[model samples]
Target chain A: MKLPEPIIIDPQSVPSLRWGIIGPGRIAETFVAATQKHTSQRFIAVASRTTGRAQEFASKFNIPKTFANYQDLVADEEIDAVYISSHMSDHFEHAMLAINAGKSILVEKPITYLPEEAEQIFAAARQAKVLAMEAMWTRYLPQSTILRQLLESGDLGKPELLTASFCADNRAVERLWKPGGGGIVFDMGIYPIAIAQEILGEPSSIAATGKVRPDGMDEESYSLLNYESGARASLTISGIATLPMLASCSFENAVISLGEPFFVPSSISLKTKDFYPEQTTWVDESGIAGHEGLSYQATWFAKYLSEGKLESEVHTHAQTVANIRTAFEITKQIGAKPF
Target chain B: MKLPEPIIIDPQSVPSLRWGIIGPGRIAETFVAATQKHTSQRFIAVASRTTGRAQEFASKFNIPKTFANYQDLVADEEIDAVYISSHMSDHFEHAMLAINAGKSILVEKPITYLPEEAEQIFAAARQAKVLAMEAMWTRYLPQSTILRQLLESGDLGKPELLTASFCADNRAVERLWKPGGGGIVFDMGIYPIAIAQEILGEPSSIAATGKVRPDGMDEESYSLLNYESGARASLTISGIATLPMLASCSFENAVISLGEPFFVPSSISLKTKDFYPEQTTWVDESGIAGHEGLSYQATWFAKYLSEGKLESEVHTHAQTVANIRTAFEITKQIGAKPF
Candidate 1:
């Protein structure tokens, strides 16, 4: 069986937007670096709670403006959109701040701590006629496009089972243990959960079990999502150990697997169920590696904005809300503190 | 860190028993072939429901006697022990018959569909002063011994997580879909569930969800087993797709993984969590491949019997019952037809 190819969009072909950064952190640094290096999108301003940090980040990223407060950044008329890289707990406030100012916004994932928060943010953005998208960068990668095409093609048959896990030794990360810090569910689990929702849609039911830290944060978890069509997904996430980050879907006629670090640019293989089975593998040839692929989301966001869209067509608002809802249900079932 | 080595026992060092076969089926053929080629254990009698089938199996294995009934085989004066490879639904009855006849028996996994049945079989064997062992087979592999030692050594720290999956396309097998045929839970899920129980012991609770076919057999399933020590296990089993049959444990200090086809003779790898992670892989060097490793369990059974043991020390009766109990709970949670 011939595997489908990804429909690659050149970053230069999209209309560039003057972007502002909120709560410039480590991930924000990667996002700015990747977008600046690979896409035509430009970062014009940055903001932090303190002016000193904002100035430092602005100087590092070669931005023209810096803000002592996120409000100032969102109010800046020179900025067309804001990348909300604030702490997960602040995503709702930051995103709404940008949307109220009529600036299109791309918020870091989990998008918000709860599904209700995300729904409110998107609803506000929709009413304001400003675009809002969750920065689920994996959804914009070329491999993800191929995966979507594969599922749509129906050549692999109906997907029966999906398995994905994200685990790493992040036990020393202090933020994860704090109340409202969102823990591993938001930090790592969202990747697999988002992808599962992307492929299998909303599950009919979910069963979850896990370990919780003394601080009331979930340390590790396993969730089994059952769909109405008899499709199932098994998701595992942890902050205490390093596990193979693999995502795979088992279909009636074939099995498609995304290699380790599945949420990033990686290899995808398809093995057909035949008397003499045939296997084919496709690897990323985009010349972009690791988190550098984050640029794809930026360019796509720009294209969506130019198209007069108020939400990402790839990672839609409904999908983001559904993913967070699944995570919320898992957190509740595990007896962990709600985010 | 240097990995520990498995302590292998030479089959010639043990006193062999005269074995009698009940329900000579496909698996029984593999057992006889592997044992005759790799161990000193001898098969003296063969039995099936019909005289013609018994004669055919007996002649193929060059056995001296054939019995058309399980009772006749178990009562044979020269037969020291019986290997029960009967239909899963018949395990309880066949095992009780052998124990009543004062015959040692190695029953195929699962030993019985329910924990209560297994308890009765072991209880009867104890009263009769005869050996009764569940032919888990995987527990006797050299790699399994090494895995046990690695866990006991504490080099991997307290095990925090375990993931194991067993999936294959067995939809074509008619028996699996039939009522009382034991479905995928008994046929395939037992391997991963037994190994999980072997490594983690009894879990505090289990949560399971799956797809049940129209005929009431479980088509696929996922389970989360939570332990009191904050350890969690995620298990996936299916009959609708072929999954990478790998088992792995993530520990505080390191991760140990059994390569694909983990329930059989395979490679083991240990990766330490260090600034510069160290990885070491050990492959099977005993020249035993695939089902050929079935001979290991037969040899171990002989050794245990010669030592005057009424149960396998490696996979104790308590452990076997615990594994079935886990499976039973999973089956119930998935709402599949009980065997």
Candidate 2:
């Protein structure tokens, strides 16, 4: 299984993974930084819809090469992997371009604006025998791994319920209110849905409700998911508000809750009946958020490419496909457009 | 308008409200301790369904009156109010007795376990001109009041979403699993649902899913509610297991989360989107569990009674009825028995 943990590479002795950015937007800039500091991942080049922006970002980031178009980045001979931080509506095209070019790809969240687009990307990856993963960053974070472990260990008791919300204060952000790739659930909800499935297993039934934007997208959505094991989850994500953005699991003997900065929290709690209710928090002792170790995801891609691995264990191709479909179902229930 | 703050009062300092208790359980003990330490309220009598238990509890707690039959306590002219903490199934009958006896009443959670009973009790309160309320402790907690203030004042921004769960480590508590009120939503889920309505206003529509026990009650429930303001909420509660029993609100700029012991939390967080993601935590300086001026609620009731106010603002006649009905609706959505 592909774990999202950062690889221990000696910066002075070991070579770094060569990753190229295929979109020079703000998220792309953050991707470059993550690839640079989160792991021993090197930024080889950058591509932008606009040549000027790509060249400027390349120069600012001190990358070795720049591409005027996404196709150029995918075909770059020196790039081992491509990070697709394109518009939500463009994920399918860019990811397919990079996969067919024989490079491992990391597509930004929502994977694609629609589930069919995600299916195409996955199918292409399977045909090309290249590594592909939907970048649900929270899945790769340390807090998430700890939560999964706690749930499996019976530390909190039998997992019975979970409630999560991944909303951002996106009301002031124009894209959230617009029809194309806008709305809180599409932008922020994907995380909670995916995480809920990862921890609680596939839901057997779904009940959802939400507030739709004037443009027909779900600006905010809430969903109740029921699993075959009788476990249930309540998940909400919105583009117009701020939520703890963390997942919580309840058990028969104890409770495990995530501590915040919501989306990027570093600590989680494990309390038991023996302790009655002891407050425990795990802070990031590594302080690696802005360091090369943060791009551990890029490093994982480099390994998969070199080792010829078909999929990542941390985020399997099957999981990504399922999650994207879940997002669509939730939206559909809330009276929003599927894309 | 009344604020929900615990008031510290000693019985000797002022006139005490004479009260009678009809149960001998942990929650009953809490009522006793809260009245003794937190409010200027006196336990004048106790009824335990039998002379042995009634005499034992009264002797243990130093009560001045003891009744083998619960009806005797209600008929006592000296008692001003009756606190009914008996089985949820008995609430309607017992409350009717107290109302006929002309005593004000405060009953345990589930508020009779039936919407019909809630309506019955509410109508009776109006007819008798007596103060009657459900002892939803969280509604009277400082955390809830503070949460309301934050929402009304737009501190974190408009409510984007709400996610709350209540699950107990019900390893040995079988009564909680009985037919009438033995599931998570009826037990723990109502806290968050009520809080959501109090803060975000009533939801226009709601969808729910859950695991139903053999006895016709849902053991666990997950519900999604959409408000007219374009806001949504996800709520869950269960007796099957422990997931982080938390109550969290996501707003436009920040989030506020709460959990056990929820009535008196150890800490709370307010996160805003500044450069550093401005996060602040408010931890209680006091180191007591559910002992944070809990007696104040009883005192507030006593004060209201003295002031000739039939309904205290802290626990209004209408809000308690609405909260219980909301719980009933959630269960109704899941195809479970409401009572």
The alpha-carbon deviation from the true structure for residue B12 of candidate 2, after best TM-score superposition, in angstroms, is 7.2
Writing each residue's lDDT as its tens digit, candidate 1 over A109-160 gives 8798788999999999999999999999999999998888988887877778
Predicted structure with the largest lDDT when compared to the true one:
1
Model 1 RMSD in Å is 3.2
lDDT string for model 2 (B1-339, tens) is 112233333334545879999776667886787667655678989998755987877787789899888888899989999988887778888888898888888887767666677888878876898888777766655555555566556545566677776666564677766665445577667677777767677778777777676656677777777788766777766666665556667666566766454555445566664324566665555443555435546766676667766675755767767667678788887787735
Model 2 alpha-carbon miss at residue B167, Å: 2.3
**TM-score for the A chain of candidate 1:** 0.97
Determine the TM-score of chain B of model 2.
Answer: 0.88
Clashes of each: 0, 28
Q: What is the C-alpha lDDT profile of model 2 across A1-339, one tens digit per residue?
A: 111232243333334667788877877777677656556678888888774998899888888888888887889889887888777777888898899899888888878767778888888888998888877766656666766666556545455777777766666676556665545677778768777878777788887777786667776766878788766777876765665556776665555666554346356666654324665666555666522233655655666666777677767877887787788788888888735
What lDDT does model 1 reach?
A: 0.87
Docking class of 2: medium
Q: What lDDT would candidate 2 get against the real structure?
A: 0.70
